[model samples]
Target: MTTPAGSGSGFGSVSWWGLSPAVDLQAESPPVDPDLQADTEHGTPDLSVLLLGSTDGRHLLRTLARAALWPQRRFQFYVLENNLEAVARHMLIFSLALEDPEKMGLQEKSETFLEMWGNALLRPPVAAFVRAQADRLAHLVPEPDRLAEQLPWLNLGALKFRERDALEAVFRFWAGGEKGPEAFPMSRLWDSRLRHYLGSRYDARRGVSDWDLHMKLHDRGARVIHTREFRRWRDTGVAFELRDSSAYHVPNRTLASRSPPEPSWGAHCSARVLGGHRHGALCGLRHRSGRRKPPADQQRAASQATPLLSPETAGEITLHNVTEVFREITAWWRPRAAQGDPEQVRGDGDGSPEPAGPALESFTVHFLSLGSAQTLHHKSCYKGRFQLLYVACGMVHLLGPELGACVAPGGRLIVELAQYLVDLRQEQLQGFSTKVGELAQTAGFAPHPGAKPSETLARFYKAGDSGSGCMDLTVEPGTPPP
Candidate 1:
């Protein structure tokens, strides 16, 4: 379950989205949509950014929303990801996100995005839409001409053949022709996982979820998600914020962070602080073959119980869902649609209203397989190419020469903290931070000396010359470099 480290048995973590909220690069925090007209009136070069391991396109979507997605200026996002599922999921998100207002509407797009983004199951419409895109996505991979014809802005040719094929196979499964969607009982699986995750306090799963929502999530001060919405998501693996859709029980096994995990995995992802348990790396993320099932009552407990939170903490946090959080983000679609000739909608060459137009030509995302990209980064062309390098949390070991080579001199490096784990303590977070800072230093980057100790966002400037230092950082589980 070490999802961030980018290691596994050809599988993704159970969670499709990062537990931590999405972040924007400080260098481009408030992205001014190049405003091509404003640009033509003035002038601006394309905004180039390289994003490493953007879990499931949330960061990218957040960035796009900030950019206002209009002609403002050309945008190039070189998205690097190792997980094929994330790639397949990314394609789906782009499809859903780009649907014109006439077809999906702002609320529909935001709701659908959140559904497909996190839940293992989906509403009927979403499921049907996913199935419809299977053939098109499958075909789009093998034909660069079709890729260009359909998603003119998206570039997937850089991916390896095997990676592309794997992506195709993933879409085929999503098609639901071979095996029925019944194969994945997401609610049952969600309950089973909750039981396992809660360990001895399986009966207190509701209480735990509440504690995590209020005592943990709210304890951080404020969050975009409300307790009710968070509880629903935690319980069902589905978010029903602006939710007009039906039961999200359709089993989006695609979000499963991994293929069916093997039973023999005894490794722990990282240190977790369970209340009664000592601070240490936690394991047992996989279910062994022929494992006994929990009693029916216990299995039904999480489902039968209503949402709960500590009495004293009820008013401690806001009880609002993220409707407004994403409502305005989705608002970007209306203007794009209303502006004259109705937004152009291409369905990966299928004539469906999937990807938005005009902006497509200027807004391109280079889908790079992490492993393949790592190899590609070694080439001379990769030297000093990007103004910013974003390293996802728990993936610090990957900031070796290959990654370091891509940053332009004086370019910035942003390292994320493992802020997802609600129960993780300050010392544990600091431990993660100090380890990352040290790794960044070794990788030829240094953070500003003025960065506060407790700050989660770490901005690092490329140290010394462009090609000054290169070192391999291999951090073992539970043992970060001292």
Candidate 2:
């Protein structure tokens, strides 16, 4: 098989202890179209395998290669090493073991070797287990009932997979449909409890390197096959740490030392090390599937409109916005109710307390712009039974009988328009354009002389008012009031 040129190389200058740099053999090259014609005349192998590794990875690679159905398949190896020294060591050992059968005692030394690097595989499985347990536990709890109760503290513990079937179910779910002794070797089997334990410590923010990549590939609809039948090597080596540490650690070292020597290999290796190619591939896949990035203009508009509120400002604004509307509506209701002359009410013989007066119980605040067709609606329910309607807008007309209240932009109205409509259900209010002279004659409402009425008004009545009515003034399609 012809290997890509820059397949394996160490990341520049940074000494990562012994970890290998990531390998990317196809960085600059476009993804191979699955439909592309193959050169069958050359008699290429049936399968193409890309083996990425370093010094420690030699044993794993040899085991895999030996177990693999080769000759019928083409195997392409890419070894990435941190330094020349490590690469040389891996090459010498691998070549000797492959060429001289008598010099290879890998099977005898397998247990001790694995013990040195076992955590590399064990940690990830443990984390997956923990997460599954947490999810199961959460599913068991009754959400609504818990929410309804006013509990100061609630502790829901871990889940228990009591049956072998339960464990098998999880394994199958993750491993997918292809399952058998050959497909999944017992060596790859991990303790089921590891899932639960590791899941508990899983941090999405920190991210899972291998799983994240796997998910990215899966999301792109890539066909991934898992062979569980491979020989299991016990891990006993130093744990690989990818965060806040040198990249020359366990896995990196292993990857670097085993990469192929080719220019394309280096480029591919660089891209993989930087995570650029994978990310780009995922994005490209998403784009090809009709998922697109927002247009620049839309993005700019969104960024411009995103309200930047400081913590203190946000809190104050929220509190004040709600409280101001509440207080204003309450003020409007208090006087309006007192106008009913409560003192004149005849008390019951044993008046313990007169049944509660109809005070402002709740209110719905609507913020609207007359010039712009944007409206923000907020509903606030009060303890009392009565309801108030608060309208904050640039300009509005409260269609009332003979008494129309016009509010300028940024003004508020607290009258219950719905109640007014109910009261005037039968009344037919005449439609009249707001004339400049007539508007000036109104006591509380005045219109700008230069401003023209876009449309004639249609009137209705207020609730509980026998003769009181209201008028709805709408703008014409072509004409907008100034």
Give the Cα error of residue 335 in candidate 1, in Å. 9.0
User: What lDDT score belongs to each candidate, Candidate 1 first?
Assistant: 0.54, 0.24
Model 1, range 1-482, lDDT digits (tens) per residue?
Answer: 32221121212243244423444332332223343213363264465677776656656665555555233455667887656767787888787766665777655665565555545568877777777776678778778897899887689867878777767766765666455544445566556555555556657656666666566545554343356655665566554333454655577645543333432111221111111101111111010001123345643563466346331111111111223334544555444434454545445566555545334555688887657545656667556666667776645567766777787666667776665455566677779888888888887877754333434456676754423222212421112124
| Most accurate candidate by lDDT | 1
Off by over 4 Å in 2: 1-42, 46-55, 58-63, 66-71, 104-106, 109-482
Task: For each candidate in turn, give its C-alpha RMSD to the true structure in angstroms.
Answer: 12.1, 34.1
For model 2, residues 1-482, the per-residue Cα lDDT tens digits are 11111111211221112111111111101112223322265343211211112233332232233221112222222232223323322332232222222432433222212212222222333233323432432333334255124211121111122222232332232222332223222222222212222343323312332332234323333212111100111011122221222321222112121123333322232222211111111111111111123446654655576656222221122222223322332333233334475663445689632432322221111111111111111112211111111221101232221222222111111211111111111122121232222332342333322222221211111132221112113432112223
Q: Output the worst ten-in-a-row residue range by lDDT, candidate 1.
A: 281-290
Question: For each candidate, what TM-score against the reference?
Answer: 0.70, 0.18
| Candidate 2 similarity to native, TM-score | 0.18
Residue 342 miss distance in model 1 (angstroms): 17
Q: How many clashes in each candidate?
A: 11, 74
